[model samples]
Target: MGADSGFDMVPRLSQGNQDRREWERFLEGVKQYYADDEQVEVGPRVIQFKAGEWPSLPMEGHKFLRFSSKITGATAAKTGVENYIREVQELAKAVFGGRIRPWNELFDVWGFYRWDFVHATMKLHNLVGTPLESPAVWLVLPSRKDIATPEPIPLTSVNNQGNTDLYEVMAIPGRGKGLVAKVDIPKGTQIICEKPLFTLRSSAPPSMHHLVAEKLKLLPNDKQREFLSLHNNFPGQYAFAGIMRTNALPCGPGSSVGGIYSTICLINHSCIPNAHNNWNEEAQHETIHATRNILAGEEILISYANEPSQARQRKLRESFGFQCSCELCSQPLQAIQASDKRRADIEQLDETIGNPVAMMSSPQKSLAACHDLIHVLDQEYGGTVIALLARLYYDAFQICVAHGDQARASVFAERSYMSRVECEGEDSPVTQKVKGLMRDPTKHPSFSAYSTRWRSTRTARPRNVDANSFDKWLWKLSG
Candidate 1:
């Protein structure tokens, strides 16, 4: 059968691909600005500006002379937000050689100008700010009309799943500001869904300081105070960068974009975190969900690394200018040693399970290795490892379907869907695909790849089997 044999239930564009397409569209939209006489870099440009210095126009003309007074260091600092808009208007003329037009006027233009990138693309609006010495260009992706946008649970809706009122911000000892549950939060409950205060490019230029400063200035006075209140480990000249480094969260699958959130950034780090953070592309927000039941008064924590041992986690924490004394890090020396060994074994099993040669020659052994890795992760990290668990279960589901074990594939696919819904949102493409597989495992692309060996109906659960016995049977565990 062909790869497209299934009902095509899954969304075609992955988050990574969507981002790339948006960037390409942005490049195409801005291509007209590049002069035929002068060679300009094709992609995003990183230009550096000195403190209180305005960006030099890429396209120069006599029209720029009018803005000379406003662009100077002494006058730029004295200008208020109102004057800043006029400055941007003048700068836009200079940058585009009077060819710059409103976004609606630009026929192919799509995407909102994120506040942080307003300085780079001088489209004047209420949220606009002055240009930085080295303005960083940000390409915002146009919203996909084909995919249904997932609505987040309203903050005030009491009956909604994962109500926002369940948690509160408080000062915890040792850890500065941390989120705490006011009441018990069950697994998969959404804790927070907040749009970022600003989204910055990871490869930002040195003039990012000025860009950040300009963005902050554009905020209301109250928001400006709130932003300044966040933790800043880097205390010297570039205070803005310091605060950003301490609080920025990854915005997507790739590291190209980093976002700052006032509330989510307050959640502290733990080697064994009870909560997990996810970037919801559909909602365009950073979401936090309880990976396990979190008791009242318990501090919310999320892991900072993928698979950092205790020692490595400690080292990673030092960059935040503090040492972690979480449950995992506070264990006895012998316990820590045992935990490290378990983590090492989990890594080894992961590698073995992914080996193509092992899968072809010893499929059973490969499946068993995945089971072992899941067990180790559960024992060590508990529900905090739900993301990894979801991936592993999906792998097992694929293996079972490929070898024609519809019964096992159905169970694994159900598990994968539940775990993915808990980790990613229920609307996620992975979760939706797994849901379809649970309904009809034979529809999987790899279902006919190998001859039927352990074929059975999708509903082949043993009657009267206890929960423990069912799990053992599902995993093919020996007595």
Candidate 2:
């Protein structure tokens, strides 16, 4: 679970004294990098990569840096084919993380300084302005002429980073950029699953711009550009700090460590969002699920972290540099007050339910509070927040299992398992663990932790009981 203290493996870009030629300094650095290699091909532009397809297509060359390769070389001829072009596409992906960009260029522009990939052609123009800004390996690629390329696909929402068929990441007039649903997305559908572009440890220093730069420096040329393209609210401060503060999500619950995702960061915030995001520990990636039926063209928004309007406003403004006029925040004054009261009640119940003293001294009272909390939540959110519901049911399950009440525990655990599946999916470790508990409540680690006074078999849950009778039996309510 522990990460490196810092990015110590990535090399620092060093400055030279006014004693040697800049070109000589560059060559010396390149030699030092390849010193350990057995074969040193000090030759022309080499497009070296394992090609996937047969029947190579004619590739004249691609322009990189300031060089234009006109004469054909041995290395260039070896790699100047259709398959090598695919390798370039794969390489360009390191920069922007999109498998298929709108321009439809497939160029290996990752390590290149100022490399451009457009229309199946490669050119170096913007980004890192100077070669010194890039690592020593950036100077190693062979020079080649850009040949006439095929037409590229136009820019559209369909050209998203991942299998984002249901939604599109694009420019929003007021919000800078946001994800909008391309289709009517059903509730509980998994929209996105992505690994972090950059995951900073909890031990990061107060001023982490330098470390951010170092991390970017170590990555391929294209990846750096992709990450830097994300919105940065603080113009006056370090870009990484601003972007990280603005877009990074936590690695997990209570994990101070934050991760920046290529597509996830494009999702704008709302106090009452239509989508819910979660980090799965077993998968080592993040996922976003539609909390409700999201209509086509509607912006797919996620709660930065839903809280009281006052807290939400302060955090959004301070951290994200935007005043939230979300549905919950924009509600009329009376309704807003009512909603806040409901939220406050939910928080209070959650705190009390989590208290050991409240569970021990007044177990039945805590169960009643749990029941009341669910009803209040039904009024406020109408079960759209399945993760919250999952947790609430999980708490009730533990309470039953702790007191050795397997029948109610089985029922409660089943609810938790179902709710968890709606959000985290059945494959999720948390969901699977809940499944185990539902099948056999005694398997819960906290089973019989408090007392076994209410012991019963899991089959004690009545099969043919009426709904009204089942409710009384489940909560132990005397009729």
Candidate 3:
């Protein structure tokens, strides 16, 4: 869809110099941001922040230079909120486009500045932080805070219409009455339909705790006994928790403590995951979706995604004392060997792209290689390749700017922003920062003036492109 880029029919201030007093006034508005509690609501219950909630919460490292709020005395024709939004949007463009200098270089640079905003907001909003980095300047909207809640949604159990033995007990090695495919389950089919035995309002810890005493304390006495009776790797009461630790899926928010659902945790791990768990943060829910079809009696599987390489996947599976017989992990020796070679090639390219010396020595070549790897991955796996490509695009943006290619830098910045939105969701810090940078690459304080050395303006388009412009790849929209 097209974006809103048309000029407004209202009078505006000079874009060159934002007066010192004006800057102070903007800062003052930011200081009172928390005071307007009515604008933001959060927490497990989906509470809305009333205007009064602002002052109750602390705001130490939350000061922002840019402020967006309607002036109280704004004319009746335009509400204060509308005027405020317009002012901020225009200011964002001018400052990002180089029409005016930002408050400080550290607070003005895209990556650094965007992180500061996201970090501060996350702290205040009680949102959990993941280990991923964003490439844009993203602001949290009042409407889209759904991904924060760690609770699982109550999903109706899938009916066992075709198979009478839906919950039939079977002696599966390593796991109890496991749910095997009753028939050839098609790709994207729901394999198992089981509810969480009990929902814990805590987050997951960094490692497993297999000691019976540790597990016993967390569950009710009767439930603890039931848990002990379940299939386990350890025989004695001492390592029941440890067996669970080895088997359970780590589910919950980034903070507090995480919980393990007995049923879902026992499905085991597979490199070529037959099932995938998707968490809906805002709704406080999780749903496991099937990736591909499974044969009758096939064991359901899920991936850690921690190990992308086949060798690493084997190592991980072997560490758990089970030889992974999954199709991807158990491919023919030659095919497995070929897959490893592709993984090694991708890794080598990653190291070369990440090398400081290589980046500075021939950044263009490094970026081109990174782009080629991303293209190859996309051809093989579709949209799953976005996360890596997003990071590469952000890296390319920095490289382009360093080499004085503003136009190319701008293009990369936009691609980085869009890719991040798909990978990490729109509310992510990466999206925020990239969006800010994409708005105006040339205005960036770090923008280099040495265009001659960079000389990247040589368009990928041809000079004599009058006829058959449709034949060019640039005209086609990305799918």
Candidate 4:
């Protein structure tokens, strides 16, 4: 092997050669190894390059050898390649569905892309992985230097001939001019629907006066006034800043910055909300749906809690300087006190129910304890019971399958899959694994002694039972 051969094996990692002395040393080593390459020691073993195999190298000191060659010129991994294909499919669907079909015309006429780059990036991230908690992601897009800026979308307003129930703005105490109900709002009702008045995605913060002023300049005179009238704590400042502080609903990922809505901002806050603010990309609409029956003259409310709970509800309301007086909060003191006691009981029971020691001698007692906690939670929250049930069922499924109780394990597996699908969506890998168990419970290698306690033919109610007796039975069965 020549000195040139030594230079070819440069110590530099990737790209092209640049340094001179390092390159020279690499040339010397390459030449020496080339001359007697079969005996060139790399730790405990010699490398025979011609055979393209390295002898098993022993661990140095206590360090384990983990070596994998970096593939040259590879920009993405196999998962990345699969993701690209998935993205292409989504784009194809969007185009065929007409969401992207007018992109050329839309961009040419408006001078800016329909969807900003930041939101696009966020959507891509969500497509790949599921975060343990919240699903929203934040993205910032570059502002355009060219093209005339579009006018701000207007807040929905009253029309004389038609009932302006959807458009009428009401003054909410603490929070300013919130939209109020002129009529009864039914469950799943879409109260307000309007485009974003104007959106700013950049990190740069401007004074409220400046932001509102800029938005006003883009809109017609009447719409401008409506936008200005929206609830904002800081009235002296620009309408934009004030509205943001008062009425902005979080539309972005992970609840970072609050987003302003032209019409939806008027909806009030409730611990137990009748209405839910939701986004529909297909319709290009931000909608409010009633979760339960809302009466005439009652204020439509949306829960500010990312997760529905009394504690989180209070925190959100306090942050905005208002005490929520929703129906739940307006309930009798005794009822509220009972609810708090139940919550505390559940909290305490949580630790003991899952403890292995508690079940050491009597598995029945352990499952019984878990059942009691779950029943209490279920009474307080309807479908929320499914989330805890899913987890408990999965644990029991593993135990049942381990003990070769295929029928019992299969029942738990089905329950696990159903709950997972309802909470996390059917597409999630968590749901997929549970679905696999549903298919073949006993086939799982985990099926053995661990499942013995949960295995029972009487999975449901036993004989004639009263409400309290039935509850007791549930506890004992689960234990």
lDDT of 2 at 365: 72
Best by TM-score: 2
Q: Report the C-alpha lDDT of model 1 over 348-462, residue by residue, as the tens digit.
A: 9877865544554566887898888887998898757787787778777766776788999898888988887886778766578779989999987667455467677888877
Could you estimate the TM-score for every candidate? 0.63, 0.65, 0.44, 0.41
Candidate 1's TM-score: 0.63
* Worst-scoring 10-residue span by lDDT in model 2: 1-10
Backbone clash count for every predicted candidate, in the order shown? 5, 8, 36, 18
Which order, best to worst by TM-score?
2, 1, 3, 4
- Compared with the true structure, all predictions reach lDDT values of 0.59, 0.59, 0.44, 0.44
lDDT of 4 by residue, 61-177 (tens): 111111111111232232232232233224323212211111112122211111233224324433221111222231211111011111111121221112356436666565555
Candidate 2 residues 163-228, lDDT tens each?
868888778876777888999999999998988777764333346777778778887776777777
C-alpha-based local distance difference test score of model 1: 0.59
